[model samples]
Target: MFGDDWLWMAVQWSPPYGERAGFDTSTTVMLLVTALVKAAFLWLILRAPLPGPLDRRARALRRLLYLAVAYALVLWYPIGLLPDAVDTASQLALWAAIDVLYLLVIRWRSRVLRAAAAALFAVELAGVADQLLDDLNLRQVHWGEVVGLGWMVGGAAATVLTVVGQWRDGRWSRGTLVAGWASLGVYALVITLNLLAGHLFSGGPAVSVIMDAAGLVTTVWLAATARELPTENSVPDLPPARLRAIRVAVATVTVLPIIAMIHPEQAARLTYTGWSTDCYDRPSFGDLKPAQRDAVFLCVARGMDGGGPPMFPESMSDQAILAYGRALCRAKDRDEQEAILTRAGSARPSWGVNPWDLVYVCPEIIGATHPELLRSAEETQAANDAYIAEENAKCRDPWPRTKGVVQATAKYFLFVDGDPGYLVHDPGDQAAEEEADKLYSGDGLVTVGRNSALVGHIEDVSDLCLTVKAFRTAPPRRTAGWQQVEEVPIVSRTGRLTVPEMGEDEVGAGAPMPNLAIKGKGRYRLRVYVRIDDGGEEQHLVVVFPGASRKKLTLKP
Candidate 1:
């Protein structure tokens, strides 16, 4: 009778504003208030005074209905043991059964009352079978109530017919008259409130408050109407199994309230609020328009250089395009978008910027250009391979540059021989004496800042030259920046070494020996800076240290 469909929606729904979700103090208070109402109603029905003519079934049905309502709200006892699905189903089923019983009770005394109750029950059972399968979703069962309102009204008309029929039969009594009116009136009031709740108070605290008040009022009406029912003298026989089940149910519902209060989360584990009727749509991203460009990162290239044209030797500009490609693609205006692309280019050469993809490659700005550079993948690999081979040729032992030096790589190797370590060796693979071949190697340590600093030993002492192009202490350690001092020449016609040794060396058939030795040990930071002839004017920084630790630092490619 109560909380079957419409009222349950309002009762179970939370206020939209705040502190609605989860088990908390406010929700507990609300739940406890409703449960107390149920318990109070149950006590009133069970112990209230009654006249001595009502059937056993009628009295039992009232008590059963009260029990179902009380236990559903007071969830702490044994009824809490049932799964929420079963609990919900049982509530609906019990109420529907009560409606059927009420129809029976009023059917005899007043045909109008009996017909009205029966019609109400029929309206409830309309989509009940489908609803059970549909999991009690209100949308599925609500349509019947739409039609039921008319049936409910029609039953009211039957009330007049019923009163006339009863009075003519000479069986009219005041109790019967009151029961008839109460039955039809209560159903009509409830149906009307339910319709109003759906149409007017759909969401908010007011809806819940209104529904709760209606439930309380309905309970009060039932209590008043039950008073008009007179009790029978004899109790009907009951099956032992049924009696045991009833006792167990009563015990369970009684115990559940205590546990539910103590452990609310567990009791509510299988419960959920109904879905909202509101709907939300998604946001828009506008559109993407294509533009003309050779580089993959043209959009980002423009952004880096302050709206100017893209330069060469692309650095991290490509990475920028890759990161913001989506947003760039979404740009609508072509010239404005192209301006973004124009600024995307970089002048500083990064590791990934090499080998020539003409699609975006720029030789003049990227240092030096070569004919072998190609945009095709196949051509790039071939060019790199040929370049590697040409470089190895100009190594320690020079090879014929038949391939026009497509590429060249300069490498430094440390040479070792005597304990003095300045001793370089390698004969020209001939008998010594008439002219002994010498080895020249920069690999050995020369503690320059210290007293012992042998720049290097050269085979052709006359061709050897040492000119300090530029010198300064390394960056941060210098504080004020690289402090430039003086440019001093260390090697001349009289080389650093005079006495020479000879032997066959690995680099070539014969190499020069280092006879120049350091005077003593000191902190040395003398390093080599090379300018590759084939790779344009780009300089490579290679720092060599002065100890047996042999630490080498290659600062850039």
Candidate 2:
């Protein structure tokens, strides 16, 4: 007898549901119903009279009873009370036991039955291999459904051969063969359709209904076509003691190799993969209904390519981070957008931009608690600043305008650290408050600053302003405006003035600028705007260098 509380936990941990309360309840009910049906089948088989010796019928009856007991023990009882690791081992052991018994039955019959048994074993072995290799990648294994399909196919084939052999010996009736074949054909078609539609057992209620119908039909046909051997031709049956000994021997012989072959490390790896929320996470969009959850799980398992280590921070649960990141991308907030990309990093990056326009655009949209994005942004900004510094050093007079241009370009190109102020404000404010609160409380402010600052900020004042000015450049113009455009000190051979022009061209042929002066040493500022569009709606602030001389300067917006 099982306690109700233990029974609930047992149901919670078992196959087909795995700790989901509603699914556990439904599966519990299903197992109970299946157990009852199997019990009834055994009772009916026992009640049917034996045409040969009592001992032969008794042995057959015991075999059916043993199968029923095994089903009840494994599927209906508290076997899942074991730890998940142990439960999996137990389940495999149970399958081995059943397979051995089935093989034994075939061995007891004849050479033909032995050959059929070998074929069935081969199919089962192939199925197991399929489960381990192909189905692991597909993430679509349903052991119950797979076993059911095999049973329907294998049982039908065996029954057909038996009927044919009997008919050859003049021991079969037309009605029995017709009924068996008819039932098999219908069941096979239904199962085939179910599998094709990706329903199978995982479809829940609808597939359960089909399974019930198939079971009922098969049971009825088997009952109607039940036959017994003649007394004179009956094979000698084993006594209960001998049968039990054989059962023990067969169970040991069959189960030991499988048990030994089981790699705990491999099983642990697979168990973690299947149950961990990393590879499969809930959807952030649409209804959060059960169906949607299932769809998301299936989609993530099947849709995403390159199953590698997760990109999100380990502190955040894989499922939560993935869901939030996906939602953030959809919302398209610039900060959140950058955060997602930063979090994805070089290793995994994104599959591409989300097509759905759900737009989760705030930094807070990343589950608020996950600051991995912020941390990553800080690191990126520091790296970008260093790269820009290194690049600026290569330039002649790398200060003010040149330095600012390099910084701006670096920031835009790298696009990692986010807006400049993002890194400093949060920690700076927190530190200030902590110091103030400690001083006011007479606890003495705890000094917490390192020789090297954690935050990254621009060092040079001119570079800072220049970078700002570059960022504030007007929107792109429709066409080049000659009137508003300033003649550059350097010009192309075609008479067009190009800013920071690399090639040699005379100053007289180029366009010009106003308030243009090259500051001593490493600084320059030109207070002129060049209209680069016909609409004259947009312009560029042209900052010139020493060698640059102008023809004409114009300022326009």
| All candidates: TM-score | 0.27, 0.31
Per-residue lDDT of 121-235 in model 2, one digit per residue for the tens?
Answer: 5565545554444423556455687685775577556555544544444433443344456556655656564654341123333344334434543444444333332333432
Worst 10 residues of 1 by lDDT: 277-286
C-alpha root-mean-square deviation, each candidate: 24.6, 19.3
TM-score of 1: 0.27
Name the candidate that leads on TM-score: 2
- Candidate 2 Cα misplacement greater than 4 A, ranges: 1-47, 53-117, 125-170, 174-179, 182-226, 231-482, 485-522, 531-543, 546-557
The per-model lDDT (C-alpha) reads 0.37, 0.37
lDDT of 1 by residue, 1-557 (tens): 34223333434432233543343453444455555544554554455545575567778766765665455444425554766556557656876776666655543465655666466556555434444546645345454655655645655555544444433433334433433554455455466556554433323343344344334434544454455345342223356687567447534533343233332232222111112111121111011112222232233233234544343323433434443343334445545444544454434223122223222323232223444432344555566546544543444312222211121223222244432222111122122221221222334323221122233332312111121211223322111211122111122112222223222232211122232213222232434333323423222222222233223333322
